[model samples]
Target: MSRDCTDYRDIFLNDRPMMDARAPIEFAHGAFPGVVNLPLMNDREREQVGTCYKQHGQQAAIALGERLVSAEVREQRIQGWVEFARAHPDGYLYCFRGGLRSQIVQQWIKEEGGIDYPRVGGGYKAMRTFLLETIDHAVAECDMVLLGGMTGTGKTELLVQLSNGLDLEGHANHRGSSFGKRATGQPTNIDFENRLAVDVLKKRVGGIQQFVLEDESRVVGSCALPLPLYRGMQVAPMVWLEDSLEQRVERILQDYVINLHAEFVAVHGEQGFALYAERLIASLNNIQRRLGGERHQRMFLQMEEALVEQARSGSVEQFRDWISVLLREYYDPMYAFQREKKGGRIEFAGERGAVLEYLRERVNQRV
Candidate 1:
C-alpha cells in the first residue's frame, strides 16, 4: 500500500525504479526507463477481460476477471510483486493508468506477502504524456548545433566524443541510410519519442549551452523525427566535416563492410555472410532509381566483385574501390545538393581532427 500522494516530478527527476504491471504485449510495444514489466494478467487474459468489460458493466467485468484468475494464479502474481519489492524497496508499480489494476496488485502483495508496494501517481499514460510534452519544452529552450556531412565523414564518431552530443540515430536504432536497417526493428514511435525526450531533458538539466546533433532527414529507419525537432534542425546552423575521398572510402569500408559483416555474424551466425551479400545488393537496389540504370548496374557488379574477393581473402580492402566510386558518383553529389539547399546555414567546415578540436574548444568555452 502506497502513501496518500506520489509526486511525478520525483519519479522523473530522481531516476526511481519502475515496474509496469501491463500485459507483455503492451511492454513489448513501448515503456519508459527502468520499467520492468510484471503484468497482472497475460495478453489473452487481458483481452478477454477487456472484451467482458465492454460487453458487460464494471461489476460483471470484475466478476469475470475473478473467475478467470484463480487463487493460485493470483498468488503467483503476488509473489512476483513481493520478490520485486524485496529487491527494490523504493520501486513503484504502474498499469495503463494509475487505477484499479495497480491497486489490486497492491492489495494482493499486502495480504499475501505482507509487503507494501506503491503504484505510480498517474501510471503509464500520464507519465508518457509528461515525457512527450517535455521534448518540445527542452528543444525550445536549448541551443543547437547540427553536424552536416555525407555518409562516412566520422560525424557520428565526433558526436559521441563531444560533451553535449545527442546521437538521434543511435536512439532510433538506425544508421539513417538506404542500407541503414538494423537486424532488430526500430522501436515504436512512442518509444522513440520517450528516449529522445529523456535524453534532451538530461542535457537541459546538465545546462548544456549547445546541443550537438548530426543533421538527419525526417526518417531514420521507420522512426520519423517529431516535426517540431525536425523543424528546429532545419533552421539550426551546421558544421561540416571535410575528409578526403580516400579517407572517406576507408571509413565506409570499415562501417558498411567490416563492421556490418561482423554485426550480421553476431546476430545470424553461420548464415550471416551470405545474408550480408544479399542485404548489400538489396540496399543498392533500393537506391537503384536514384542511381540510374547504368550506374546502378555497374555498382552492383563492383559490390559483387568486392564481396567475392573479401570472402576469398578474409580482407574487406576490396570494398574500398566500390565505396570510392559510390562516394564520388552517388554520395558526394547527393550531399552537395543538400549543402547547396542550406548554403547559408553551414557556419564552419574543416577536416576530422580540425573539426573535432574546434568543437572541443566550443564546449570548453561554454563553461
Candidate 2:
C-alpha cells in the first residue's frame, strides 16, 4: 500500500494536512501548520511507558503500554484515527521519529479498520530538519532586500504589496513593536520557525528568488527571527521607507488604536474594550524604562485619559496625542539611531511610493 511517504518537500509545499501521533506535550512544543495531534498515547500513558522502559526494558514496557491502553481505550483511539483518516484521505500520520509508536498505530488502523493509511517515513524530527535546511539555504543563496523605516511608517504594508515579500511579522502574528501583540498570543518559537521556513520554501518554489522583507531586530514581540535570516538582514541592501510625522502618527493611530481595539472587541466580545484598554496600557508600560520615569508617567496619564475618552465616546481621536508623542520622542529617535548605524547598507530612501517603486525595480532587475 506504500504506507510510508518520505517526500517532505511535496508535503509542505502542498500544505498537506498531517496527523501527529506524538504526546500532546510534544506537539505543543513544536508542530507544523495544518497538523493535528491525535497522539497514540496521552501524556500520562507515555510517561508511565517511559519509566517502565527505563526500569524493565523494551519488551516489558511494551507490555505495560498495552495493558494501560486496554481493549476499550485502544478502540477509542483507533476510532479517532479512523475518523481522521476518512476525513483527510490524502493526509499522512507521524510520530517523533516514525519509530515503534507510529508503526504500532499504522498496524492497529489496518487491523481494526481494514484501511491502509500512510505515515511520514521519518516523522517530526526529520521534517523539522528539512525546514531548518530550507531557511539556511535561502539565507545563503537568495537575494533579499530589507525595508527599513521609523515606527508607523507602514513597512509591513509595503512588504505585502510585493509578490516576493516575506512578512515576518505576519508569520509571527505580531506587529514587531512594543505594541505589536494581537488579541491572540504568538505561536511557540518552534512553530514560528516552522512557519517561516515553510513560507520561504513555498516562495522559492514559486520562483521568487528575490524577497522583500521588513527590517526588524532579532526579536519581534515574542518570536525571534531565525538566526540565518537575521544575519542576512544585517548586511542586506535596504530601502528606507519614509513618511511625514503627521502621517506616521495617523497610521499608528489606525494600526495600534483603532484597528487593534476592533480586533480585541471581535475576539473578546463584551470584555473586548476593557481588554483593549489594558493591552494599550501594558504596551505603554513595556517601554517605561526607556521612556524614563517622568515621561512614562506623563505618557501613562495621557493614555489613561485617551482610553476613557475612547470608551465613553467611541472616538479614537485622543489616541493621536499619545501616539504622536511616543513616535516623535520615543520610536523616532530609536529608529533614527538604527538607520544611522546601518547607513552604509541603505541603497535608497524615500516615501512609500518611491520606495515601493524602487523595491519593485530591484525584484524586476533580478528577473
Candidate 3:
C-alpha cells in the first residue's frame, strides 16, 4: 500500500526543512526558506529526459532517466538524500508535481540507503499557493504604518530601528527606485513574494501591532507586491520623514554613487563599472517627461561629467553635483505633488530622531 502524502501546510506550519528534487535552474527561479536544492537529475539529464518524453513517451523517458543516472552516478545522488535525511530526519523531499522524479528518488533512497521520506502532496504548486495565501492573511491581520518622504529622507533606515518593520525593498533586494537595481540581480517574482510572506510571518510571530512598510510603487524591481499588501499600504496611516535638501543630497550621494561603485566593479570589472554608470544615466533619463526636456538634458550632462571625474580620480565627489540637482529639480517636487493624493492620511512629519522616537512610542502604546 502507498503511504499517505505529506502536505504543504504541514511543512509550512512546522517550518519543516525540504529537499527540492528539481534541477538547479528550476530551483534558482524560485525557492522558499528551510529548503535546499539537491537535484535528482541535473540540468542536462533533465533536458534529455524531456526530449525522450516529447519524442517517445512517458515510459521511455523514465527508462532513459534510469539508464543515465545509474552506477556510481546513482550512488552519488542517493548519498545527498542520506546526508540531508540524517540532518533533518523529519524533512520531506519534493519535485515539481510529486510525480515520477520524486517517486524514483524515494524508491532509490529506500532501496539503497534505507530512508523512506515522502514527497510533498501537491509539491511546488501547492506550497506556492500557501505562501500567497499567507501574504493575504498578514495584510488582513495587522495595522500598518507607511513611511513617506522625498527621495533620500532615510525612511528605509528608520525601518531598521523599528521592531515591527518590514522592509519590502530589503526582501526584494532592490531600492524601490529607478536607480536601485543591485549588482546581484533581483529575485524571481515567486521567490520575492515568498520572502515577503516569510518576513510577514516573522513580524507576526514577534507580536507586531503595526508593521511598518516603505512608500513604494506597485512593484519593486522585477517583482510586484502582492495585491492585498500593496492595497493596504495605500490606506494605512502615513508618516513622513523630514530632512533638509543638503541632508537629502548627502544621503542620496552615499546611496546612489559614493558607496555603490566598488561592488559592481569588483564583480564585473571595467565593463561592470561602465554598466553601473550607464544605469545611473538611464534612471535619470527615465523621468525625462516629468523633469522637462531642458532640465533632463542638463541633468544627463551633469551625471556624465561626474562619472568622468570619478574615472580620473578615485572618488565620486563629482557625482554629488548631479545628485544635488536631481533632488532639487526632480525628486522633491515629485514627492510634494504625490503627497497631495494621499489626502488626510498624513499623521505626522518630523526629523529622523523625532520619527524614530515616535515609532518607538507607538510600539510601546501597543504594549
Q: For residues 233-334, could you state the per-residue lDDT of candidate 1 as single tens digits?
A: 989988898887878888888878888888888899999899888889999999999999999988998899989987888877677777887889988998
Every model's Cα RMSD, please?
1.9, 1.1, 3.0
lDDT of 2 by residue, 228-281 (tens): 889998889988999999999999998999889889999999999999999999
Q: Which regions of candidate 1 deviate over 4 angstroms? A: 4-6, 363-367
Report the lDDT tens digits of candidate 3 across residue range 1-367: 1363655555666678889999999999899875899999999999999999999999999899989887898889889988887788788888888787778878877887787777787777777887898788878877888889999998999898888898888888898887887777888888899988877766676677578889899999888998898999888988888999888888888887865686678778878778778778878878888888998888889888888888878677777787888878777778999788874898888999998888778777874
Ranking by TM-score: 2, 1, 3
lDDT of 2 at 32: 98
In candidate 3, clashing pairs total 0
**Cα misplacement distance, residue 107 of candidate 2 (Å):** 0.7
Compare candidates 1 and 3 on TM-score and give the better one. Answer: 1
Superior by TM-score: candidate 2 or candidate 3: 2
Error of 2 at 5 (Å): 1.1
TM-score on alpha carbons, each prediction: 0.94, 0.98, 0.88
Error of 3 at 274 (Å): 3.0
- Candidate lDDT values, in order: 0.84, 0.91, 0.83
Q: Give the TM-score of candidate 1.
A: 0.94
Q: Candidate 3, which segments miss by more than 4 Å at Cα?
A: 1-16, 43-61, 68-72, 87-90, 269-272
